[model samples]
Target: MEKESGSMKSSSQTRTEGSKEFEFTARDFERVRALIYKKAGIALAESKQEMVYSRLARRLRATGISSFVTYLDRLEQGSGETEEWEAFTNALTTNLTSFFRESHHFPILAEHLKKVKEPIEIWCSAASTGEEPYSIAMTACEAFNTLTPPVRIIATDIDTNVLNTGANGVYSIDRLDKMSPERARRFFLRGKGAREGQVRVRPELRQMISFKQVNLLADNWGVSGPFDVIFCRNVMIYFDKPTQGKILDRFAPLMKPDGLLFAGHSENFLYVCDEFKLRGKTVYELDPDRKTSSAKLRRA
Candidate 1:
């Protein structure tokens, strides 16, 4: 009884540090930011400190805590506040991705799939709310000229709520406004009544992809993959150097030797000299046989 009480007291002290005004300091933001980067490969700026705090503030309030200091303390102390951690990570992480968000990338995907010889597997690492992955699937259907069993997509996200929504493959009308008219008509089913003007991705596209909850930081990945392509766009900016390296190292084995990797326009391989070889400006080719090098690259 005494030992358990002491442990509880120590936990309380740790949490108290976070709950105090001192807990939400610049240093605390940096600590949380670094942890997020390490865990999710999310790159965030100090300017986002307020965003993190404010978003988390609402969550803390929802949890019946009024002060960030107390909230920070609860977060740090693990005072049975696992929901707080999930809320923190979910709110801080960006999910700005959309269906065919970067329309330009689809042609690249089509071109790559045209060359794949084996069972084609694609991983949409930042597949948010299912749009992107669904787009990939529909693109595959277009690429192959038919829906075949061989084409598959694995879409993963850190947020369960979004994962559920993605798996549902539903979206509002406004979000669908950007989709090309032909694609929109073919791909979306118009909802009515309470969901009037909203849309859901057609079952054909939704069926081709599998959705799962994944945190990039957790160990082992519990996945066996040798993908033909990995769409890891817009995900690496949140991570620092070492975290980026570790993720790439893990990413390499999941990709085939000649597999293609696509990243967001904002990300680059300029600083990452190892793990993956540059295939093009926004794409990489995993070359495990080649040692990591600072090799000059020009498109063939």
Candidate 2:
């Protein structure tokens, strides 16, 4: 018993303090590759085997692990490996988000939200760093002030790191440069001198949005929503056709009638037949709302 305890303690110590020249065995690559794909739909090519190791190298070093295999073992054994997985996902997942990233959609949103003249509920399906949701809030501030209820934004992201940033509601000035000066002045409060040049979205606007974790591919979303608008922008491009189609199919029931769906500029109903009308790239009004048969989108 004493010998077993001693050996375990030594193992834990070494695992906590990792070594240099971390070697990721083929088995490690296989395990992580499938894990990423299964969870996030990120398909890693054979060439990317070293890319994972290279990216994880910094993480291993930060945790004092010098060898890839050692850090890999640490990941398997550590109680906090969930956070490590988040770090890995953040490193690997493409985060191409910015405020008002695809400007075209905002005017449509403004017009639609204003037209509804009802309690507004919007979803930023891949809210990322909260910029997209904040942009939505700002647009609402300018567009729907006279409405009976202010806009309600639900900002969700699978990436916990970005969601945490989103919850913080603070961002660099550069992130806000694309925002209109008047809107920026109205919605953003400048960070103090020590944190100079940084800006934080006003609490009123930030409070209007709820940030939560949601894996779109999961069996159950655990979200209570049939959102009036779903801005699932830029997140679907990583998926293959079957995956994209299935996602849209599943997402339809989660939307309200007359609600709009916004995909990224690069995504569309090209092969995603049946459920949507080809209103335009990045825009699809829910088919059920189409008063005319002509509004129905065709299979390509």
Candidate 3:
């Protein structure tokens, strides 16, 4: 039976009689694509048309706008633009990550920690929902055999929503599946009573991290670096080569001489940037000589 009360459900959300579907034209899509790229360095392909329509349709509903064209007009005319733009960018951003998603990198990080006798600072450039930064904290704790290990992590992302989540340091119990039980016990506190089946990052682990919302394409990252390790994984795949190269160039000066840069498995910087040499699988270090390291150069 159809509901008697009307709600602002998206038109494309479901198929029903007499409900007007939002008109999304090719011109509208192109306009949106252009706007997104200009605001954020993300390149949206033609195939993302449906996705664009679906994501923005909800925005239309919320704003009580009838069509995509009207919304686009409002957005471009600079009327209540700041909040709309923030919503637009947040809606389009993609963040998929898990605890120890790239399992191998953690061990390498641990080894890097062991070798570095001085203080260590790490920048997690795509900290989606806190797992990656918390994992870094756990690894540091294990490597140093202390809760108060001397390490600092700056976790940043363009999405304000996810940064808030990361700062909260809370997760469903199942988020720990990929992690070993021992490590989970060490770093997370299991919730009780009303919060059962959830875990929160232990105070010690939370203390090591600072979460912030940062757009990587911006002129200033707002965080001091010269970091020992930078986890910029699974983020560059969305950008074109030129954008990737520029970001890499910006990253080079912010890291130590032997600092490590971790890339996504699908990302290969060999063709894009000369500032970093591939030190291991998806791992890179600054290459002052600009000579590409051979694949035979094994991981330490």
Best candidate, lDDT:
3
Ranking by lDDT: 3, 2, 1
**Candidate 1 at residue 199, lDDT?**
89
Model 3 off-target regions past 4 Å?
A: 1-20, 290-300
Give the clashing pairs for model 1. 15-73, 18-72, 18-73, 19-69, 19-70, 19-73, 42-238, 43-237, 43-238, 233-264
lDDT of 3 at 11: 47
lDDT tens string, model 3, 42-110? 899899988888899899999999988889998888856788888888889888989888888989999
How does each model score on TM-score? 0.82, 0.80, 0.88
Estimate, for each residue in 1-300, the C-alpha lDDT of model 1 and write its tens digit: 999999999999789756753336676677767656654667788789767776666676678876666666666678476666777778887778777776788898898888887588898887767777888898888887875546889998887777888999888888877777887887789998898878888888778889987787778565566678888887777777777677776777677667788888888865764777677768888665553321322111
Global lDDT of each candidate: 0.75, 0.76, 0.85
Which candidate has the top score in TM-score?
A: 3
TM-score of 3: 0.88
The TM-score between candidate 1 and the true structure equals 0.82
- lDDT tens digits, residue span 1-300, model 2: 999999999999777445536667778788777767776776677788767877777788777867666665665567476778677677767667888888888888888887764677788889988889988887887786731237788888888889999999988988877677887888888988897989998888877888988877877766655567888888887777777887787666666667788888888765675667766657997675433432332221
Off by over 4 Å in 1: 1-31, 34-43, 79-81, 288-300
lDDT of 1 at 159: 78
